[model samples]
Target: MRDIIEPEFEIDEKGRVLCKTHSNFEFFSQPKVNRYQQRELEKQLTCETCSHFFNDDCFFPRSEVNMIEYDRKKRNAFKCKLCGNKIDRMLTVMHKLYYKEKYNIELPLICCTCYETLKDGKFIESSKWRSNMFLYNALYAIYSLISVLFFILVYQVRIYYLLVFLLPIIYLFYQNMKKRKEIKEGMRYYQKYFIDSNNNNIR
Candidate 1:
């Protein structure tokens, strides 16, 4: 006789289970597209300055909207021929598919233009402190090395004299800290801008 065992639990990407089964197997649906992909598609489909597809002259034939009335058009009104869904929503769906097929990444919803832009560029240019930190640390190390050499050659100072060379090190440290703080603030500002831009684009 075959043994019968009850199912343990269900699995899902967002933790919301859809069903339970008699077998001891689990299933999970895919996750949504990511913000990076969405941002990329937005860049591809819309004008960087205005987040619309066309300009005053309607230079791009593929654009769905005329530049003049682009702002007045509702997002839900523009339908995709392939999916019969809103153009923006269709873009998000396509982006998710593309991300899965191309990069093997299960991303959240992303607009068409943002996906294109990210695919073309590979990644966004968000500010980070690592670069600044590297620069400051490199400079400080170089200056410290030079000061140690000078002390040894001119004053014949012992290796302990290296401790006295920390004046420049402290100064550079302060500058690096300040610069890192500024970069962090700038990152927050840009993050806010990204969120605001996404909200406006959806509307």
Candidate 2:
């Protein structure tokens, strides 16, 4: 006679593997791992209807097998899992590092979909404001030059015209300080928002 080994419990829709036996039956759950990698995987796996694929907050397999396969294919060439867009992970990493150094912040590893969304949303606003500030400063410099000519023209009137000329210079200095503060604040807000939003999405 042959003995039979039965599974203790049924595998749920959440990708949990259950062990079932005659003597003892219990549900076996996967363990937690690095969240950064997990978030990247979440963005990649787009099929929501698949029962085998559950959200990370619920019980699910860590997909080690898939990860190994992905790594192998990535070494050769693989498409972005989310959008089916071809991407080079190494080049992506280098580009990310370049931007991080340029922007002075650590950007979370993200796929093209998320990156594009973020760029369109927050980055565009910051860049626009920065550009406006530059334009304002340039205009201020031109105005200062015009004011100097006005001072020269009016110099024969009285020494008071010289004091009047100093007013615009002082105002320009104040505007420069204010613009600098605004830039610093804008950058801080953007960096904080980026970090917080990505962290929340991952968690």
lDDT of 2 by residue, 1-203 (tens): 33322222333333222333212121123333577744553343321222333332212233732453465356534433222334433324333333455567664344454345455676446445654775578577667867776777867566566577767776776766555554455445546665677777633
Off by over 4 Å in 2: 1-127, 138-157, 196-203
lDDT of 1 by residue, 1-203 (tens): 33322222332333222223211112122333787753553344222223122222212222433431252245444432221223443333433444565569864433333334335642134234343664677577677778677878898778676767766676776666655564465445434554577677633
TM-score of model 2 (CA atoms): 0.29
- Find the candidate with the highest lDDT and give its number: 2
Model 1 alpha-carbon drift over 4 Å, by segment: 1-126, 129-164, 200-203
Query: How close is each model in CA RMSD to the real structure?
Result: 20.5, 19.5
